[model samples]
Target: MKFNRQKREEIITSKKKETWGQEIKRNWQLYLMLALPFIYIVVFKYYPMVGAQIAFRKYVPAFGIWGSKWVGLYQFERMFSHPIFWKALKNTITLSTYTLLLSIPIPIVLAICFEYARGKFFRKSVQMSAFLPHFLSTVILVSLINLLFDNRTGVFIHIIQNIFGAKVNVLGDAKFFRHLYVWSGIWQGAGWSSILYISALSGVDTQIHEAAIIDGANKWRRIWHIDLPSIRPTIAIMTIMSMGSILSVGFDKTYMMQNPINYDYSEVLATLEFSMGTAGSVPDYSFAAAIGLAVSVVSFVMVMITNKISKTLSDNSLW
Candidate 1:
């Protein structure tokens, strides 16, 4: 009788909801695991935001960040009025849009291909080959591009001359800048990018695919109806991420690939930021900071807008 009473009380206690603090205490190990990331974010991400004030201040190195004169939006006004700024902005948008447009679908298709591929060894070898290029540094990749596309001794140059009856400066030509940039990026990143989709696809229930098979669904129909819907949320998330970075292209490869002839087409916000920030004897740190801040603001706004649209159109969103 006493044991029965104790069992009843234990059952009641187990049914009771945990308070926030109590739950944290119970899952302290998980919370402990999160502490490092929380600290890192606060230190590296949030802390530097204080220095973003340099964008508004005429940041004289002699006077330091805070001691410098606060000129409000003068830096932004200067940036906006510059023709080079406009050119850089246009190039940045064009390159990023091309990248984003191709980045999304290619990865999804590649991941699906990897999933449906037969023969374990063949799939692994192909995936490894595709992913290997991702580890190459930007400088090395640029060097390889030079070697393969150089106007004089490049292998492709001979083919181009043979086919077109004229020598084309593939490396130095302004017209080829965007093509080389976007396509090389696709080749380098497509496999690495597909990893997330592959992970999401792997988690999909096999029973669902089997059931579809039983219902007379061909591979195409099954992929269209089953695999796609299962991974729709992942696709939505990737789309939002790509839209968020629509203005922020990387610096190293673009800078390395850029030469005098292609500067007009290749100049982007990051390269512009570098040139503005370190422009010889009298570097305009304030203007550079302003440009950086502007890019970050635009990126953030893109993420928010994309997230809202995603939420409205579908059930998946970052929030």
Candidate 2:
């Protein structure tokens, strides 16, 4: 009986190995193409996971990552006690929430408009104009923003001042920072973001539209009943993904747009990490790492929660 079982196991193992060999042999070129990306993820993404250990250590430059003394959660304790960390965390969440709330619907609306528009030429023109700004680098975008809102030279500032005989510094005012950041990002990314929805809309069954038309459904009714239902899954998925990053605001744009006057409202976690780790006289590498780790943990938890909620409510989730 033992010999019979062993023989059966051997046959199964041999078959599995043979199947793997056949797969590799048949798709050797495809495996070769995958090699670079595999190496890239190993080198760039997974490898850096080892360095995350610094968050739990006293990361002295002399001691190095591995050689650094283990400090448990000392850095995290310091971060929790730091006023700037809380401020930065608060600002980061606030900005991200505002951007998410304000920017999420614009792309959907624009994509729907594009799908429903009668004039192909006008749609293309509008799409090109909306997409053009996304290509601008963060530096150039910030510079353009400054030029457009500068207290003295900004066209909008000039017009407002001329019309109302009042001075306004939109960039300098902390009250306006969130609005500027969110709206500028909307302007830059709305068209690009809508492309996915547009593609989804295009794939909608033409037969459904034809049936709706035959049933005396107007364009608005078709959009309401047919178009939106078709893209509801996409919308739910996009929104779930967005909710996952409720703490991550891009550093470059925030940093470039940030000034002393707006720091109270604009100093997000990413910029704070940059400032804490590199900008000071004595860099607090461990503390910065702890903050980064905290942010990552929070983001992961949020993603999980968002995915769970989405799955429960809509049966659509990243997982």
Candidate 3:
């Protein structure tokens, strides 16, 4: 068109700005959709972070958040020196590790099994049955466990007594607490947790399987090569998420299942925090806050490290 250089540049800039304006208009709904979650994070998660300062202070309820006296890391120092804090930390770590070891692979295995099931009916039934426990309230679940394992007259105890003539107290013994807690957690959650993996697996292309079949690939070969690859990223992401929660062993289950005899093994950070906050004549808010902060920091670091390792090993990372 033999336009002047200045005029040409102006037209190009105008066109680029128009394109950007159109993009903003097109994606405006997405930004709007994200607004609520953004607000929620700020309101619920980030906002409460201001209270983390109490971890380093002699947090006085009367003085309020800002008016509280700062003790620097004195609370943290006390937490480190406290034997019960170490015990709770050790117990928390032990139980979390046990639960993770028992629970993390379960959903993957269940997903694979369900994927390979012979019929839709069987798969659906299995999935429904497995997922049903997750619907139960923790109180109800604990009640059911107690009913089934009641030392004198419970079903499991009866069976053990009949077979081995040994009356085992499942809830009363320190040794059995971790096993019972972790295994029950796995049983309650594994099936429901598999739902995500199953959904991810469902998204895998059927055409890939058809191609593998045409190439005379066996069922195992197709699954090993195709199915696993399809869900690898999902597994990686879930594993990273799971690592982040390794210190957050559920308080309800442990607290409900615990008794005086089993308290040594069953005490975890959450339970300790609860007891420290509520059991005494006066609540030790600062101490509890310090412990909570420590747990959160450790969990966050673990997740970051796990995500880094996953990124290094695979092509996927949560970041």
Candidate 4:
């Protein structure tokens, strides 16, 4: 029995090696195809991690990354104490929250509405129009927004003033910046975002809908009882992911939208990091790195917390 067991173990080890060798030999081209992406990730994503230590060091160009003196958490301590840092943190959270409220639900609602639309041509046209904005470059989108909301010459303001006889500077006001940013983003992304939920909706059983209809269910009833429940898992997953990034408002559009007047409301972590890292005569790379690391840590913690809550409340989570 011992001799047979030892022989079986040897045979299993040899077979495992043989199977691995055969797999490599047979799928050489497929492995080669994967190599490009592997190399790209290693170079662009993983390699940069080595530089993250700059957050702890007083990075100087003359001394290089390795030669820089370590300051431990001095940069983070300074960041936490700075008033502008707090302002940036607050604006980031507020804008992201506004964005979450405005942007996430509209897509789901639009997708459901589209599912109920009877006119194929109208639905297709509306979908096309909604999707076209998503393809627009950031520069063009910001430019178009500026043109539409220009206090002195905008067509929208012109119509409003001519009709009501009151001039309003929507673009210049800090209060209106978040509204414009969030709503415009919703308009651009709603249709594209709806594609996923619509796909989920399509998978819902038509037989269930037929049964509900036979039982005297109305359109709203079917939507409420059938459609919404069918897509609740998708909504939960999307919500969790969005909550995870509650602080990472994009820099390009926000930066472009920012002016001296709206800086207080529009300033966020990304823009603040850019300002700290390179905007002044003397760049503080360590300080910027500390802020960036803080944002990442906070985002990660949010994901973990949200995932835990989602699992406890609804039994749905990314993990």
Best by lDDT: 1
Name the weakest run of 10 consecutive residues (lDDT summed) in model 1.
Answer: 11-20
lDDT per prediction? 0.92, 0.89, 0.88, 0.89
**What TM value does model 1 have?**
0.88
Instruction: Answer with 3 or 4, whichever has the higher lDDT.
Output: 4
Candidate 2 TM-score, true structure as reference: 0.90
Task: Flag the better candidate by TM-score, 1 or 2.
Answer: 2
lDDT of 1 by residue, 1-319 (tens): 9999999999679658667888788889999999999999999998778888999999888899889999999999999999899999999999999999899999999999999999999999999998999999999888988998988889899999999999998887789999999999999999999999999999999999899899999999989998999999999999998887888998998999998989999999999999989988999888998999999999999999999999999978998
Candidate 1: give the clashing pairs.
Answer: none
* Regions more than 4 Å wrong, model 2: 1-30
**Total clashes in model 2, counting residue pairs 3 or more apart in sequence or in different chains:** 0
Q: Estimate TM-scores for all models.
A: 0.88, 0.90, 0.87, 0.90
Of candidates 3 and 1, the better by lDDT: 1
- The sequence of per-residue lDDT tens digits that candidate 3 reaches over residues 241-279 is 999888888888888988888889988899888887777
Q: In model 4, which runs have C-alpha deviations exceeding 4 angstroms? A: 1-23
Clashes of each: 0, 0, 0, 0
